[model samples]
Target: MLLIDLDRFKPVNDLYGHAAGNAVLCAVADHLEDLLPVNGIAARLGGDEFALLVPFTGGIENLKRLAQQVITSLVAPISWNGGAVKVGATIGIALIAAESDADTVLHAADLAMYQGKREGRGTYRVFEDSMDTELRERAALEAELREAIEHGAIEPFYQPVVSLPQRDCVGLEVLARWRHPTRGLLGPDQFIPIAEETGMIADLSYHLLRQACLDARSWPSHLLLAINIAPQQFQDRDLAQRILAILAETGLSPRRLEVEITETALVQDLEAARTTLTSLQNLGVRIALDDFGTGYSSLYHLRELKFDKLKIDRSYVDTITMSEERAKLVDAIIKLGSSLGLVTTAEGIETDASVAWLSGQGCNFGQGYLFGKPMPKGEVMRMLQAGPRLEQIGISSMPESRIHAVPMEAIIHCGVGRAA
Candidate 1:
């Protein structure tokens, strides 16, 4: 028995509508039919899921090969409406036994398929007895998460985003942390995917936003509060309104709030994202594209969306000191931001060299452990009250700035910006 689940299928439906989604599904069905062995029964088990029951005389090795082939076939992009719609499949294999009931076999395969998803996309897992226990634990954790959301147990931690060269605290990025009763303190990685999968992300996000907004009430007016919006939250048509309402209730001005979104969110539904972003912008809120270099269509998104800031992903910054090519890329990104009148923030700046290089390259903002890790609300309050000073945090003085203002000469040298 093979249970297959399609990944990234919703994004296609969201971007191109249900017609494109149905077309892609039909294409997948055709591929399954072509790939199935003799006497194998291929069935559509419902939305973006399929099952294959094959009468096999072969060993487990052959089934493994067959699973890989199915994965390869299903992952190919299907052309739709003059564009390509791509989706990936995760397969779970279960061997049929005379004593096993149909329901039991299907449940085992389902658990295995979910395990494959948790590991990563486009992989296969064979049914194992241990998966059942894992599934139960996951269910219990989900229930605990739901209760925690209701009780507002999830807390926000703030990481400071400092000005380049000067290294002054300019803003704080709010991150989520869960205080689990049995598990102690849990990071977002432990429960965020579960929240997203179980459709509880919206509730959890709103809860966190409300708390963060309230926490920011004591912050200085000039200091920004940047909060990341999950990709799934973009699907909510009332997203802008809900956030605006939260701001109003908390008595925090919309101007002080920055909504950071990933490229994955933008690609999901550009029209919807544009509408929500425009609404927020009109209300004096700022929009920033987060994890900038990690996405496929950064330039396209920059052109289409009215982003106020472009955040450089940490991957580029981590290697800039060691890799000359990476340094050039970072320089180019900063130049790109400068030309577009958008502020550029570099993430994961840990060393003095990284700080010096980024500041020299004219990156406007810097974040990462070199400055400060995400701290609880109490530490954030104390830091803000104490004032923005590197000496307070025990960091040494920063090197002088190499590129200060983007003068006409520098613009000409960089091959960007118009002559003033």
Candidate 2:
């Protein structure tokens, strides 16, 4: 039995449409049949996946040759409309071992196919027992994430976004933290990719967005709540409408909410993302390009999208003090934002020296450990009630100070002054 999976198939479905996707899948089936042996049969399992079965008790060399032919024939581009649709094949082979039943053989082949995918597509793998362990671990993580979302165990930890020089907490970024029962606490780095692959990202994002909005309602209307948007989450047609609903239900003003999405999200389908942002902006919401300088088309997106903020990624910030070239790049980014009338935010400012340097550059805002790590809502409220002074970030009376928008500190306690 040979199981084949098409690579780069989703992009075709996403960029083109189901009609294009179906045409490609049908072309693959035809290619498989044309290359099949006399008694060989090919069937499409689902989506862009196909299966080929042949009764062959010959040497492994013949089976290997057949697999190579299958890949070569399937890799050719298929005509869809006036354009060409391209996808590569990843194949897995399973031979009838001594005691291997139909189900067992099929399972083995599927595991090998996935291994082929991991090794990079356009390859093939023979069945092995080791792949099962990795698959099981992935399955377990997905199960935990589903349960956590259902039980509302995922909490939003708010980190302060401090206005530079002035050091006032003008905003808080809502970060997701999973309160796993056995694992204590888990960061997004650990489970977010799994959630995205398992199709739980939309559910997870909506859950957190709603909770973050509700939590921010108690803050002063002048303060903003920023949240990250996953790349796949933008593909949803109702994304903007859903955000407006969450804002209304949480009693948070649309103007006080800032949506942060990476430049890569806009690269998928520029037109679609434009519409989503335009709709959100129509609701009086603000848009920010998060993690700048990471994606392929950052400048193009910037030119096209009317973003209100440009967040300098931490990678660039980390090298500012050490590398002269990097320092110049950082300066240019800040200046670029200023020229465009955008709020330039320096992320991951860990040291007092970086903070001091950023303030000197006339940077608009900064966020990182120097400001404060993400904290519970109760802690944030207490800090707010204490007052807007942000001396806790170790920025007490700088050598030179110039007042900016609001006289607040880098701490979450922005002296929201709306009462505890």
Candidate 3:
């Protein structure tokens, strides 16, 4: 059995139309039928994908030869109303072993086809044991994750965002944690991609955001709650309205609630993004561009839309002390934020020197492992209670701007309790 995917087929539909795309697919079917053996069965497994089953009693070399022939045949340009349509097929071969079942064999062939595409299109790859096992494990994990969301196992854990030089705990970044029944606790890095792939990311994010708001509603007004929003969530036309409802239900003040948008989210649909973000701002809630430099369109986003803050990505911050160029880049980013009036935050502030250097550069905020890891509500509450006390600041810890950053020791002492 061989699986084939037609490359560049989408361009025909985009450049021409679906009618032309269908014509190209039909041409591929014709080519497959012509190339396959007399006893072979050629099946159109839906748009631009075809499969062939050839009963072979010979060695693997024969299948290789047949795959190459199919590739050669597909490479020939098809005349569609006198316009030449060109495409190539990536082939994946799955040989039937003694105990192979129909579904398993087809899955192996599908994996092999993708492998060929990854290795480079217009080539063929044979399925390997590891590939099949990995695919099956991923599928199983996806199913488990879907069940976890329904069971309310995914929830928010927060990491603090501290004020620079002063090191005051000004806010917390809400992060999702999956309290899996069998797997203990799993962080976003472990399950977020699966959630995104399964189309459950929106649900997961909303659940966390609403819960975080409810939890933080009673916190001191000065301590903001930042929720990370995914790009997928913005596809909904009523995203802003839905957030309004969440705020209303939780009684969390919009002023103290910050929504952080990653670069990936902003670049997805600029018009929709601008409208949604503008609506969000209209509600008096602050917005921050999260992981600033990594997105596709930073300059355009800054120019066309408004942001309350810019969180510098960790990549640049990590190299500040190690490389002069990186240090200068960080300096420039801080300066840009200052000029544009965006509250600049240095993300991933790991060492004391980095914190000192960022403060010297006039970064407004800092977040990283040096301050704290993402923890449960109770632990965060304790840390919040420990605010700007000299003990929390290590009694003598001071930045170069310690005189100007007068609130460093006292501000970390801000306390939070249940609303009475």
Candidate 4:
């Protein structure tokens, strides 16, 4: 038994119409029928989902090959009204046995399909006993995450982003940490995916943003607050408007907030991203292309989007000191940022050597544990109060007056923010 789900199918219905979407689904059904084995039966399970029952005495590799074929068939766009509709599929396979009930088999295949989706969509997975345990744990975690978001248990932590050569803390990146009652502090890796999958990301994100913005109001005017926007959130057409509303509510200056977007978000819908980003830019919000050089279309994004900053991915930063090739890549990226008149921030900077190398390469900013780990609001406030030592972080001291200059109008009660 194979359970298949079409990826990005909603966009077809949304962009073209139900007719075009139906055409795509019918096309998929035809392709599945052509590939079915002898005595194989195929049926639509409704809403872009399909099921196939095949009696196979063959090896598992044969089943894998069939799955791959199904994936490849959809690679070519479906022709519709002189336009092309594109979609992909993720399949979950389960072996039928005499003892397996219909509900049990279907549940196993469904779990496997979701696993495939989570591991980067457009793939296949065979049902496994371990997947059942994982699903249960995920469900439990999802419930906890919802409660966490509702009661403000998931809070933002701040990591300092400092000027490269100067080493003065110019801004802080918002990273989310869940203050679990029994488990203690939980990193974003624990709950962010669940939030994204369950359609809770928007609410979770806005809650964090509201708190982060309120917290930022207490920082110096010169200091900026950088928040990463998730790829899933880009699907929201009114993303810019929602952000504008938050800034208005919190009274955080638009100039002091930087929005970090990944290449994944840009590639999903470049035109839509452009429209949203342009709206934000027009309102004084700075944008940074985060995790640079990791994505396939980095140069294309640079050409298409007017980004204020380029963040060199930590993978390159982690090996620059040890690997000559990585060092050169880092150097090239920094020079690219400089030539494009964009500030470059190197992520995962740990050693003084890495810091020196980055500064020498003309990188504008640095962020990582060597500066300071992500801390809560009170710790951030204290750090701002007591200027960091030059000897400790290999930079000159920040001015005392600049550190203390939080405007009277901007003072407010603090709250948590960000997914790191």
Residues 371-396, model 2: lDDT tens digits: 66776777666656655455535422
lDDT of each: 0.79, 0.76, 0.75, 0.80
Model 4, runs deviating above 4 Å: 4-52, 58-91, 99-103, 119-124, 388-420
Q: Model 3, poorest ten-residue lDDT window?
A: 411-420
- The collision pairs in model 2 are 167-408, 167-409, 168-408, 168-409
lDDT of 4 by residue, 209-272 (tens): 8899888778666666656787788889999999999999999877777788888777667778
Best of the candidates, lDDT: 4
Per-residue error at 217 for model 2, in Å? 1.3
Candidate 1: stretches off by over 4 Å: 17-19, 80-83, 391-420
TM-score of each: 0.87, 0.70, 0.70, 0.78
TM-score quality measure for candidate 1: 0.87
| Error of model 2, residue 147, in angstroms | 2.1
Tens-digit per-residue lDDT, 111-220, candidate 3: 99977876779999988888878778878889988888777777767666677787766666667777877778876777786677668887777777777877776556
Answer with 1 or 4, whichever has the higher TM-score: 1
Instruction: Report, for all candidates in order, the number of backbone clashes.
Output: 0, 4, 5, 2
| Ten-residue region with minimum lDDT total, candidate 2 | 411-420
